[model samples]
Target: MDTTQLKHLLGEMTRAEKIGQMVQLAGEFYKEEDSENTGPMHEMNMTPKKMTVSGSVLGISGAETLINIQKEHLAKSRLGIPLLFMADVVHGYRTIFPVPLAMASTWQPELVEESANVSATEAAVSGLHVTFAPMVDLVRDARWGRVMESTGEDPYLNQLYARAFVRGYQGQDLKNDPFSVAACVKHFAGYGAPVAGREYNTVELSERTLKEMYLPAYQAGISEGSKLVMTAFNSLEGVPATANKPLMRETLRKELGFEGVLISDWASVGELIPHGIAKDLKQAGELAIQAGVDIEMMTGGYLNYLNELIDEGKVSEELLNEAVWRILTLKNELGLFENPYRGANSELENNLVFSKEHREKARIVAEESIVLLKNEKQVLPLTHHQKVALIVPEDQSKDVLGPWSWKGEPSESVSVYEGLLNHISKEAIVVKTIDHSKNDRPKDWLDDVSTADVIVAALGESSYMSGEGASRSNIKLPAEQIQVIKELRTLNKPIVLILFNGRPLDLTDVVQDVDSILEAWFPGTEAGTAIGNILYGTKNPSGKLTMSFPRAVGQVPLYYNQDNTGRPLTAYNQEDKYLSRYLDVDNRPLFPFGYGLSYTQFSYSPMKVTLSKSEREQTDKIIVETTITNSGKVTGSEVVQLYIRDKVGQVVRPIKELKRFKKILLEPGEVATILFELNQQDLEYVHQDLSVSVESGEFDLMIGSNSEEVETTTVYLELKKNE
Candidate 1:
């Protein structure tokens, strides 16, 4: 339909119908059978009329189900607008890949884009028009369970990944594409930095800090043409994000230039009541609509109270019309009127869902996503000839897919045990399950543990222990698993700890005993194949940690980039009592960001910076070049990272921040020169007064294998006036 037809449909819509168009209901409400009213719908006392003409449905998929619902919906409406189907296709749909955290470890935005393309292809065929995904929230506190969904801690990296996701999901042309689903960049404006890392807690940050650190990734998604933005569940400063007009309307729509639909998170509009901002549901509707939320997800705030509020002259119909117009335009853009089925085909779904080709891509992603954390005395890449004793956690098989599996089945996932079996001879492997519930050690288990040439202790938190609503106060391995590790230590055998988890864990206690550690964060469907390949040296582990792993829970918000303190901890002042150093432990993460070990070693030459002129101008660019050699005997890949520090600024600046990085693969004795270019524009930051500008100053540049270890150099940047 054209703009004229969309306006005509809007003119014909009654207040009730218009409100329905702005409200999104759950899939259960539209089900043909199953009269069981679950928590959300029953509590809202949603009317039947609202259910029939609802604008969209959430958490529903499949061509048959969506087609039946759309048919029923269109038949009941005077002016038919087919129901929009959406689901939380966060990672992948049916063919699950590694979680977003693992994908970030690959440091390959194109690979992530390919994964998203496969995800979009699978999801679009299954009848989903939108995916509430590519969560670009920059995370520092791993205690937040949703860290698995985010790219990582750094803004630049998150920005890159967010763009890749948008490109992958929406493709080049959203209107003409059937394989691409509209990407919804979500948790807008600081949902990641909850107080004490609690879920749905208050996010308190200065406006400058918010703009400088947290808001870039969301803006990047918008720059890449994301079709929608989802409001975060947390309250920004004092205002709940859903009802914060300043943020949702002024900063996002005007300042950032986002001209798209703004949707509330699940029941977030109603949640404003408990947030103490709204007195009742009516007030919630008034605030949300006024704040520029075009769609309400799984809530009756719009359907129940929007029309009444408008009738009372408390809310304007013009505001309601604007929302309805955006919704109608989206449907029209999706070509729903032209084809109600929208590109959903059962035959395509059957062929593409979890196909061999997609699984192979998943295997490649999984292999690159696994991080080799520690390999003491070169104990990793175990030969197949070694008799291996594998001790896996009780929930190992069940939790392979991690959280947000949605349509993915655990039965389809390959566990560590299965992967080992596939790699090594069955006779050479002795498997023992360590029941996390019990402390008993059977004689057979102890006998196998002592006799085997090597022990592979596969342990981690269960999938349920992380993700949404699964925050933990103590981010450590389970006590039972640690106890089993202690028992394994007695045998004096090489213990390789393969950790399967979502968030970064406090590994200070366990790392000392384990000879080698591979952090395979829920390698999805091809988990076994990827882990097996990495184990037998068929694949070298090239993954790096996106988030810093803390040595203790006391360092809850630890990260590599931090502001310099007045009393800094220097080598000369190491014995100074007043220095900003922890007495019990050093102020360093257990594993720094971008820290990962490889089977082979790599060496870097001194970095050189070449400026276009001796004195730089604003337009002048500087080229930073470094040579990396595979100094070890084997071929391997290394993630070369570039970090920068501003010596003096208008305000305090971080000691170091990741600016650019490159992943290079080198054969033995082969050298390659990597280059990164930067200008004055790249060094700009938001000042305390909300002005964005770059200061002329001296800066420190460092190129490193990881955040903590680097070769340092100094450079100066000066901006000259345009002639």
Candidate 2:
């Protein structure tokens, strides 16, 4: 269908039908014979008439279910416009891959894209038209449960992953591609940085901070062709993001060049009433439509009062037509008019749901995502000959499929015990599975631990402990698991801690108890096998931390790129009591961002920077290079990270910012020279008055494996006058 046909279809739609096209309801609304007074429908004041004509449905999949729903919706429609089916196909569909946080740890956007492609393929076959994924929210707080959904804290990394996900989900063409589904980049404006790390909490960020730190991720995704944008639940600068005109209209539409549909998260449009901005649902609907929210998700505000607002002169008919036009345009792009059931195929779904090939890809990604956090005395790479003592909780089936793996099966997942069984003979290994649900500790396993050479303890938060609606004020290991570690610590054998979590944990208490620690943030369905391979050295651990692990919960929002305070804590001022130093704890994080250890070691030589032209020209390029050598005895990959700090700026600058990085594989004792090019414009930041410009000053360039541990060198950057 072309523009003329789409416009004709819209012209034929009634006022109610046009408003219905801007509403997306749950699948339950379409299932019941009379859904008007059922459950939350009556509470939201949704009538049965609106339910029959809703433009989109969410949270229902499977080819048969969606085919039936779409057929029913089209049958009821006067214009025969098919309803869109969308879901939160975040990480994976059936063959669950590692969570997005773990995927980001791999430092490989291509692999991340592959995982998204597999997810889109699986969901598309299940009859989903759009996926609200590649969240792209820059998060610094581990306590924010949705951190699992985001890539990491860095804007550059998040921007790269955002683009990769968009490419994978949308592919070359959404209409022509059978495997691809339209991507919806979500939580439009700063939903990740909720105050107190609580879900749906208020976000108070300046326009400058929002542009500099958060908006780039969403900008990158939209620029890469994401079809839709979801409004956040939080309020930005005292204005609800669902109805913030400056952000949704000016920044997103005019400045960022996003011509796609804008939808609300859950019932955010209706939430404006409770947010104190609107007095009633009628005003809320008007504000949302006027503010440029194209769709109201899971809310009846648009259906109930949007047309009324248009008649009362609160909203323009042009605005309503524009919103409906975007929706109709998307429907045309999805080829819904030609074939409503685009990718629905039962046979294809059965064959591709959890194919062996997809599982292999998940295993490969999980292997790269498992970060080795600590390996004191080189206790890892446990030989098969050594008798193993595995102490894990009994209810470990769901641990593999962490939160947001809504379609993942716990029974189909391999447990750590099941994976380790293949490597060690049954009689050679002693397994002590304690039922954590009960209060009792298994003292009977002490004898097995006394005889074993090494103890591999699998412990961390449960699947529900760290994803949407699961924020934790105390982001520490569960007390029961910590007690288990303490009991194992009484013995002389070295303990290998394999963590299965969704967010960065406070590991200060147990860091010393375990000899080796692997930060495996929910390695999806093949979690057990991936851990087994990395433990036995079949696959090397190369993943780095995307978010900083705080020493304590007090440092909840900690990151390496923190602002330099007036009273900075330094080596020379260690004894200065008035300085910005903690009285009880060190200011450093337990594990800094980009910090991870490999089975093999790589060392970086002093970095050298060369200027291309006069420094004043912001477009001039500067080349930075360093020699990296694999010093360890095994072949491995290293993520050589480059960071820069503005020595002086108009506004206070961060200690350092991650400019660029390279993931290189090297043979034992082999050396390679790595080069990174930086443009003078890259060093610019948002000034106090909101202008962005690079100041002529000295800058420090650093290169290292991680953020905290790096070798620094000085370089002078000049800003030339206009040509």
lDDT, each prediction: 0.88, 0.89
TM-score of each candidate?
Answer: 0.98, 0.97
Pairs that collide in candidate 1 are none
| Best candidate, lDDT | 2
Tens digits of per-residue lDDT for model 2, 237-317: 899999999888998999889999999999898899989999988888888988899989876778888877788887988
Q: Kindly report which residue stretches of model 1 are placed more than 4 angstroms away from their true locations once superposed.
A: 35-40, 614-619, 721-723
Off by over 4 Å in 2: 32-35, 45-48, 440-442, 614-619, 721-723
Q: Which ten residues in a row have the lowest lDDT in candidate 1?
A: 613-622
Count of steric clashes across candidates, in order: 0, 5
